[model samples]
Target: MASTVATNLNTLGRTTFIKNPSFKATPLNAYAKVLSKFCIIPSIEGPLKVVQQIEQQGAQTVLETVGLKKKGYAVKSHTLVKHNLATGQTGQVTAQDVSDAEYLAPVTIGSPGQTMNLQFDSGSSDLWVFSSEMPADQQQGVQSAGNSIFDPSKSSTFQRTHGTWSITYGDGSGASGNCGTDNINIGGITIKNQIIELADTASSQFLSGSESGLCGLAFPPLNTVKPTRAQTPMVNMISQSDIPKDSELFTCYFSGQSGNSYFTTGYIDHDACGGATPAYSPVDSSQGFWEVKSETACINGKAVSRSGNTAIVDTGTSLCLLEDSLLAALYGALPGAKIDHSVQGWVYPTDTPITSIPKLEIAVGSNYFTIEPEYFGFADLGNGYTYGSCQSRGSNFPFDILGDRFLCNIYAIFDQGKCQFGAVQRTSSGATTSGRPVDSGTESSTAQLVH
Candidate 1:
């Protein structure tokens, strides 16, 4: 059973070989082995597009151009490539506005390049995919996912480490395989000698989806690889001098519509921000998540009482889940909103005026980000017709989890260089709205459901 409430556990699953079930990060030995050396790789200047495609291999170097001062590391920004739209219907009801639950990009593995569409997640850290080693039934299940399987035997660059790998998610969905190193290409950026997990066994949750696998974007501490930990692709980029050393920042702009979401590495898009000033929040990476401190929340400009609230900001999740007491205070502020225990969330009449609903806002720093009525109410699921029941994009969780529903409206930046997370309202200029569906989960831990 896959939990609808997507978390790090749901994405990476549990690695059996690791003794400790709790979050424990091994020291990044790969950083020293890969990034310590500073070299000048020539840059290939081209028209500024979202994602730059690498036709010919350009030398990798730190970005030092006029207008941009020479900082710790040169920033390299990559526009997020959008995959195909995944569509379906629940009776007559269909979310034409939010057709997918997640976003995915193409990642080419091996020498000849068997490209697979992978969901880029910021929660868990592991790059596992369905491979040639999987059983026939398992391979068939995910056949449409990657298009073609990654057969290590055929690749000249494949180096088998023969290290066994396995991971089980909180929702019971999991994958396991052998570990090895190979070349992985994303957009125009290529990582050489990259460690990849070749899946031999896969659960239906993964096979049933259009996405072939997942690419983690968080710190290495949350990596699920066993025996010896593996370095994530993002770390490989920074260590290999593919990006700036002092510029370890990644920004995500996930849109409600398919093919509109995009992310940039190294640089922040000031134009897509609502305000010139961005609110910076400190992150506690000890939990292997971009966890930030949220002081309080407000509804319709009215203050809602709350103590110290810590929120895990994740792009992999679809809803804005809160604890029981905290959610009670939120929904209590709404006039017609009521707890629909069956869905483990709140619901309201679909015909209810969007503007009539009180606005929900969360305080990060000195600034506050509002969850607009159109973004917060989410989909209409109760009845198939025009207006029946509208589901609130919120659920109950032990700890607060801010998913894509809450994040899409804001410009989210994960800055490792300063060990802080920054946010601002998303501006439409230079920003896209296209996207694809990624991971789905259930209401409770181990329980599976989809939005």
Candidate 2:
């Protein structure tokens, strides 16, 4: 049977507090995609619940959710809608589709307050920070967060139950845990009593990378990970408690500013970024990723159509990629772009960089957006390896991922409650073209490299 839960994140108030779009210099968000496990697993054990007691402050049971993204199907209701391809395992969407979709904030391990780093993800939803006992596999080169680590032992309401959960990202990254509890914090706000899946394996890159464990603050019916497929931590916590009932929408503003970024609950300081909150499209949850209902796709201003069903909006991703047909429609416009079946992805000659590719625009709820060029480019993939949006990943590529490089010039807002994304023009405040507060735009063209 298909598993599911609901996200209590409903956008209630729409208000701004501060506007500081001017920052000295900030870090670029890396949304690298790696392969991950996709096939579904049996239901996990127990009726997912979050119990905060003395022994363990808070612990959340993650719901195992998985899907392979490709050319044929689409997620319409929790059910898969087969398009041209029948019995196809994966799904697909266009570049513009993802840009206009609503998304959840990258949650960290800390109290509601004290949220240090917030990550925006498109591959996985099992948002969790690490606990002190995190197995050596998880510890690895990563040291303990010390005071920041969710100290389950400190919570008087800690409960030990058999909570099994697993997450395999589209990028081949994953983490798993039996069950654990620590103070679950989000946006500097505390979920007083809660439970989370304690990752016991090598989660160093994710857990302590910057903030605490992640928070899958998106749509729910979270993935059921264990043998009995139950509710996930976020879903169960909101369901079991009366806290979210008073809320019509739990909105979050993920400030992807250079540093000092945060997850603002209830209110988003639109002025803080000197950016505007564009209209957000309702979210498509059946696909397991942030999917938006789009009306069009135009290469540099020309219109096009897509054969796939969903678009994966990933901040962790780097470029704007598309499926075979849609890409053909795009590269056809460029001077040197073609599909290389040998490599199973798209490729373009270095002779041409921009392909003069027009701004791929996606429309949501009557709002039209033009994806900027900053999202396209060749990057050092490792071993001096490099690739470009004009290129494709080998066969079985994740097909479509609207990465951060595209949003640097334009503002993208994830309004989760409305199940929509907000896109606005990215202004520099006359700052540096390097996305820094300084003046660097004079050095080169407006096309800035995220690296």
Residue-wise lDDT of candidate 1 within 1-451, one digit each (tens)?
0001112222111111111121111111111101111111112111111233232122211111111122232323322111222322111111111122256667888888888767676766778777889999878766754345778888888899956666543222357888999998765566799899899887665576556777777676666666776888877877877645555666777766544666666556545563345567788776466778765556565554445657767766555655455455556666676754323245566666766666666665435676766676655654521111112212212235576767866877787667788776653343322111111221223211111
Per-candidate TM-score against the hidden true structure: 0.68, 0.59
Give the per-residue Cα lDDT of candidate 1 at 352.
69
Q: Which candidate should be chosen as best, given TM-score against the real structure?
A: 1
> Which window of ten consecutive residues has the lowest lDDT sum in model 2?
41-50
RMSD of 1: 18.6
Pick the lDDT winner. 1
lDDT of each: 0.54, 0.40
